[model samples]
Target: MVRRMTMELAVDVARAAVQSCRDAGYQASAVVVDRVGIVQAVMRDTLANRFTLQAAEDKANAVILSGVDSSEFRLNRQDIRPEINQIEGVLMMDGGVAIRAAGSIIGAVGVSGAPGGDKDEICARAGVDEVQDRLDFAD
Candidate 1:
């Protein structure tokens, strides 16, 4: 079975993402999900639109389902993007990144509400980086 991150860790990651985006002058939301696409934690910036929450969750779920970052999945599978997007909670877009430790995927972090997906992804990576040390040392 795939391992999952602690609730505290998940929350930290989500908060970090939101903070990162805020630092960049963009209001955003972040979602952390287990390997099974189950939501573990969610953080939304105060100025972020409520709709951003669903976008963030969908991005994270896409990572869990594809075993890769959402951007790569979307780029690599363009032919199927049309049909894949029709699936509930599955978004083939950027701003989603897998959370990995010791070569294993523990979860994912997805960010949304930035002006561009790439910017959102940068915040997501920052969030994951915030907890990288803890994740690297995890048992």
Candidate 2:
């Protein structure tokens, strides 16, 4: 059976992600989604770009659906799997990460509005790591 992260947990993760991005001096939008690609939480920094929300959501969906970081999709362009991108809200680009705990994906996090994709990914990973302890405890 797939164990899902609670809504409260999702909020905590999203908050942590947003905080990390702010600390890094980048205004960003953070999105959290469950394993099945359903949105859980979306938080945007006060100074984030207006488009960050959608971009973050798309990245999160992409990771949740594809079971990998969105950047991986960009890196392996020739191996692109079109079917994964066909998902309604998926964005097959960058700044997203699949949350894996105990060898299973529990959710995904996406960050956007950074100066570069790499920066966005760093913020996203920070958020994921913030919640890593919780995931480990659950295991």
Candidate 3:
């Protein structure tokens, strides 16, 4: 049985990610996706660029497809990064963090619209940290 994170959790993560980015003085957006790369929730901060939403989703897809953080995948797989990015919905960029529970990656959180991918990744991690307690006890 494939145990996926709930939509409620997905929404919470997305909200926290966007808020974290806002607190960091960046108008950003966040997208959460299930393990299979299906979007579970999305949230965008006001004044954020319209394309940020798609960017966030693509980062999350990168994580889901790689079973690792998007940034890590990109860093470790630069040889194939360009080719991978050619695929639809695959963005080998930063700002994607794996959402793990029950000893496995249950989903991922992606953030974008910050000045840099590193900044986006920091906000994405903050979102996952916001739900650390729940993830630790997840089934």
The number of the candidate with the highest TM-score is 3
**Regions of model 2 farther than 4 Å from truth:** 79-88
Residue-wise C-alpha lDDT for candidate 1, range 1-139, written one tens digit per residue = 5567999999999999999999999999999999788999999999899999999999999999899999999999999999999999988889999999888999999999999999999999999999999989877
Better of 2 and 3 by TM-score: 3
Quote the lDDT for 6 in model 3. 91
TM-score of each: 0.97, 0.89, 0.97
Q: What tens digits encode model 3's per-residue C-alpha lDDT throughout 41-95? A: 9999999999999999999999989999999999999999989999999899999
Q: Scored by Cα lDDT, where does model 1 land? A: 0.93
lDDT minimum window of 10 residues, candidate 1: 1-10
lDDT of 2: 0.84
> Cα miss at 131, model 1 (Å)?
0.5
* Candidate 3 pairs with clashing backbones: none
RMSD of each: 1.0, 2.0, 0.8
State, as a TM-score between 0 and 1, how close model 1 is to the true structure. 0.97
